[model samples]
Target chain A: MRTWTWLHKWSSLVCTLFMLLLCLTGLPLIFHHEIGELLGTEAHAPEMAADAPRVSLDRVMEVARARHPGKGGMFASQERDDDRVWYVTLSDTPTSETDLKQVAVDARSGEILTEPQLDNGFMYIMFSLHVNLFAGLPGMLFLGFMGLLLLVSLVSGAVLYAPFMRKLEFGSVRRERSPRVKWLDLHNLLGIVTLVWFFVVGFTGVLNTGADLLVQHWQNNQLAQMVAPYRGQPPLTRLGSLEAAVSAARAARPDMAVSFVAFPGTSFSSPHHYGIFMHGDSALTSRLLVPVLVDATTAQVTDTRELPWYFSALLISRPLHFGDYGGRPMQIIWALLDVLTIIVLVSGLYLWLRKHRAGAAKEAA
Target chain B: MSARRPLPHHGGRAHRHGRAHRHRPLWRWPVRLGVVTLVGLLSALLADGFWDVVSWLALGALVAVCVFFGWLRRG
Candidate 1:
């Protein structure tokens, strides 16, 4: 409809500048995974020998706690493919409140390879800035508004497309005329080609930025119910064997591998819960986490098995927005699309200015 | 602002019949409203200290200029 076209154009014109900025910054982010790999941040956890006795999770927990004596117990543990258990914990420093620490342990021998520390690196700092501009909640909400504007702009630009392209064909670029005409044509061509990717990036970005809200909702709703029965139950004094708990959980699932475990008393795992996180074999399914809750004392499986569709959508949107899901080829394609979007935004502004100037000249004549 | 507005004219130099002459008046109010709205938004964005304040100000000025052009074309 003409009305929709007008809405799209005006919206695009208003937000294209900001959208261009996001695209430029987002280009670097798509390759963050590859960059991390190149920077040697990837480490192999020691593998357990087939004949070696399996180390107890309690032993690994002991090493992690000894490293930070006065600190609280582990918040969660991540078991990598190479047999490393990453103990993520919280401890108070002399001057500050509780802070996060991640300690890597050899699962085969329960040896602490390194002391617990913050893992803030170059890529992480950039990632934080890109996501929230270091302004935290407000910045994320602002970016969401900008993303909304971009969606509007895309629609408006497409609407103006038919009117502008009525005479010219889809790919036509009028380079022979004034600079404005040439730029406008390029804008249209580039916008059309990259429309689908732009939509994917925009829609996913909205959902991704809304993750905090989603978590809070889940916590207030289902998580509350999961924890309700455990109320007034004796707080877990000492937890059960995590390996046994993980084995029990995997036995119940029959298909997934243990990716992480939230210990009792943590947010994800209440006094009533032992959050045994699992992943599927395939890449797509692997990204979807199914947190199986096991009773800490009895190692009895709770009803919390798989995530609902909304949560699954949220989980998948992270990779979709980042362009790391498919592979390096997808990253390259995302980067190219980002660059094209920048061109479209710049050219669109130029076209609008040129039209304004032409209108002024005609008025003077 | 009142002195700047051109007197409305029904016919122009290029027109043989008066039918094509009348439609130009319909563009006047829409152009003026669009320009003013654009300026208001541009000013708010500049006040917020988001990037491209200068471009936004320039955009505001452009819309103001377009408002003038619209007034000029009323005749």
Candidate 2:
């Protein structure tokens, strides 16, 4: 126990400054969805024409192709329900070395709605820094290591809490006493109250860090089974109308909703399958459904089961990690919890510094 | 002055057995339990979608394991 207490104090002080910056940046990211909506930048998918024959996916592609003639590549189409905008083509041009363009097209009229942009500038940068420190793989790995240390610190602190609070009731800050004692009390109070929130966010973050690797593994393993039969067959032709494909997909799984569609030849979809993703009917599953791979040639529904366990877990962990799943009220609660964490961090630093000062004075005397 | 009794330590309770074997071995038990529980958590998360009942169960089990150790200690 004494060893754990020492470990807790030293580990926390080691990463205290970096984590403080991370927490400050992370707070705003928790509310990013709401803030994006407020800023009028949230994109949505246009509602399908009711009783009016739907527009053709080929037509949308044609319009997009005509508008941007120099680039002929079209990767995939993404539908955003809230903003009613369709992101049609992902393209690269010769003049720019690393610029990839995402063309947003109106689903109904197939007209190009507006210029392409990153999801959100400020929020994306902050999120990148918090999660990976913008250093790519090394940064992600380092942050994961830090998260492990955090878990250790959390456990040790809890062990020490009983000794500190054996007498006082929960929530006693002891503000009138010595500064170190006050900080310790505050730390215990805040830590216990927000334990659930922190653990969920932190541990899920570890899962999130492994997401890309999981996706690659899924593509190689489970997806291999779905594509093996069609290995030598000519690539399946992409159907002309996505709305028709969506309706066909819904007919197969009446209870499911169309989450997204992968164009044939795309990475997720098989060369012979049109991956039409659908989520569960429940509130929780609705946000992270597994894709249903539909054979584009025959319009036959092939794979309906969610991605293999690890991939699905990564998908589901994203919302809890981001604090975006629980609606506006939950976001507010998350923000409050984030502030409490900041206080714990600062107070912890204060206590360490005060102790260091006292030790120095004693040595001088 | 009247003879005074020692004030009780509010921290961990005094073990009846000698200090060497009195309470559960702190480092071995908690560290091992924490590691096992952490693995279970990662496995459950991988097996099911996040937010499933399995993840919640894993979390509850973790906290219970921690609290159980804390309860075993004196004060």
Candidate 3:
């Protein structure tokens, strides 16, 4: 019991502040699309006929490239809910991770809709603080460590609950008692209530923190092997038609829809292939991406393979952490749970502070 | 009389032991709620429509429990 108490106190104290920040930032992120729509930053393609002739992928790429004269294409993707618009991302080089631009093009008319701002917005700030604290990969890993501590704190706290609640019934607050006792009961009640939720979210968030590392590993392993035949070939001066490449990928996986296209030389693709990712229509399989490597010059499907177990796990962890799987009701429930978690964190901190002050005063006396 | 004397003492001990045994399962409610929460978290991710509704109700139950104890049921 004493060891569990010590573990709980130290671990909660170490990570409580970061967990609070995450809870606060994560609340708004649950409604990112809704908020984007309200802010008028979300682009919507004008309504077209159901059988309207859609513009070619090549035209969309051309329009996106025209917006940025010298930048190279990194990725072209559509929003999960809105397939009518293709968001083309460009950077200094194909593999550069910074100073990127996004241009939204209408899928049917090939018209420029908007250049959605990637930085300096309310949601952007929330996302940066929630994910990395604006310090990039190091910040991400630091938070992941904090998440680990949070798990330790949760386990220890659960252990301590057995002792604390031995006398009282479950959900008994004893509000007539002292403030400390009331808050302590509240802490236990709310903490245990949110325990499983907090654990799932924290565990998945920690996994998501290693996203860059996982992608790099995938690139060096499966991706490298897939493009082994064209390993030493010089980069193509003129890439093949984007339309033909996507068509080849679709023909290869007739049951799946194209999720995104990672251009040649990007981190997601090899130097000589277009990594066209395909996804299923179901809720679960949609998160699992199947990569189809197409030769950039010939527009021929070179290789196709399902992602490894670790990669699939990482992909599945995303929706569990984000709470975006269900619709508005789920988002609302997620926000409410987040608020409850905040209360738990604050009450826990208060209990620790009060105990410390009481201990100090007794010693002085 | 001597044999009967232990009877009362033994009954008292048994009664006390029964209460303690009930309290011993401290994990009862927490584990049950944890299972419900686990089901809720996974159901929505697996499918839509009916499963999503199940998820909402399961998770919403926890929030309802908190509100009932923390605010509605006051001393």
Candidate 4:
């Protein structure tokens, strides 16, 4: 019991401030899409006829390349729900994560709709802080460590729940008592109520922080073997028909549709293949993306492989962490839980401060 | 001043343990099931189309938990 209390106190105290930051930033991120639309920051394609002939994938890439000179095409993706607009991303090199650009093109006419500068703005700041504190990989790993501490705190707090609630009912909030006791009861009640949620989100968020490492490991192992045939071959300077590549991928996985085309020379693809990512239509299965590697020169489907179990776990973690899967209403629920978490954190900090002051007073006496 | 008796610290722990054991077993399964239900509901939220039912049911339970807490706050 003593050990549990000590663990809970120290763990919660250490991670509370960070957790509060996450919860607050996460609240706005939950509605990021909606908020983006509201702020007129998101691009909307001009409405074309229902049966309008969509431009070829080749034309879309041409428009993207023309707009961002010297930038190589990284990814071109169409919205799963909306079919009228195709979003194309370009970077300095195919592998560049930063120093990138996005262009929204009308699928029908191949006209450029909008090019949202993604590097700056309020949302980006929040996203950076919530993601890596703007320090990139090291920051992400640090936050992941904090998430582990948060998990430890949750477990310890739950362990102490029964003992603390021994004399009280499950939802008992003793308002007639002192402020400290009242807040303590509220803290315990809310903490226990959101126990499973905090655990799931925390665990998944931790997994997500290691995303780059997981992708790198896969690239070094299974991906290296799959793309070995292209070894010693010169990298393709001019890519073949993306339409054929997409068709080949669709034929490989007839049930799935292409989510994005990862161009050659990127981390997602080999030097000579277009890594066409295919996803299912359903919400749950959509996260489980399958990569179909097609030769950039021939547009022939070289190999298609389902991601490993860990990748699926990683995929599932994405939605579970964001709470963006169930639509707007689910985001609302996630936001509510986030607010509750903030309260729990604040009350925890308050409790610790009160105890510290009390200790100081006793020592002074 | 009256002579003070040294009360044993073990008494409080023992009494708390007894209380926990009595009600712990009773509420154990329900809490376990509730956690399962909550997890399922969260997973359901990620699902779309035909799988949305799971999300709705889970959301209903969570909202009820919130209302119950609200009522307590008011009381």
Best by lDDT: 3
- What lDDT score belongs to each candidate, Candidate 1 first? 0.64, 0.63, 0.90, 0.81
Off by over 4 Å in 1: A1-6, A44-55, A66-69, A73-98, A109-119, A353-365, B1-75
Task: Estimate, for each residue in A1-365, the C-alpha lDDT of model 1 and write its tens digit.
Answer: 56775676578777777676677778767886467567765434555555676577777777877776777554555643333556556455212333666666766777766543354777666666667776778888888888888877776665465556545544556666777766776776666655555666788898877887887787677777777777787766666776677778888888887777876766667775677878775655666788788887788887555676888889877765775543444456557657767877887778777877988999999
Q: List the TM-score for candidate 2's chain B.
A: 0.35
- Report the lDDT tens digits of candidate 4 across residue range B15-74: 677666677753574386467556556556465655555665565465456447634455
| Cα deviation of A310, candidate 4, in Å | 0.7
Give the clashing residue pairs of candidate 4, or none: none
- Candidate 4 residue A349 C-alpha distance from true site, Å: 0.8
TM-score of chain A of each: 0.83, 0.85, 0.98, 0.97
Most accurate candidate by DockQ: 3
Provide DockQ values for all models, in the order shown. Answer: 0.02, 0.05, 0.35, 0.23
What DockQ was computed for model 2?
Answer: 0.05
* CA RMSD of all predictions: 13.8, 8.5, 5.1, 4.4
> Tens-digit lDDT track for model 4 on A1-365?
78888999999988888898898888888988787888777778776678999888899889988998999889988776677888899999887878899999888999998886678887888898898999999999999999999999999888778677766766778887899988888888777777787788898999999999998988887788889988999767788998788888889899997788899998889989999988898776776789899999898999888788877789878877887677666778778777877888898899889989999999999
Candidate 1 global lDDT:
0.64
Give per-residue CA lDDT, model 2, range A1-365, as digits (tens).
56877888887877777667777888888877566667655554456754544467667667776776765433544532332446655555222324455676766777776645554477778878887888887898788777766667776776676556555654566666776876777677666645555666777777777776777788788777777777888754435455566667888888876666666766677776777777765655665666777776667777677677677667777866765544454455556556767777787888788888999999999
Worst 10 residues of 1 chain A by lDDT: A89-98
lDDT of 1 at A217: 83
TM values, all candidates? 0.71, 0.74, 0.94, 0.91
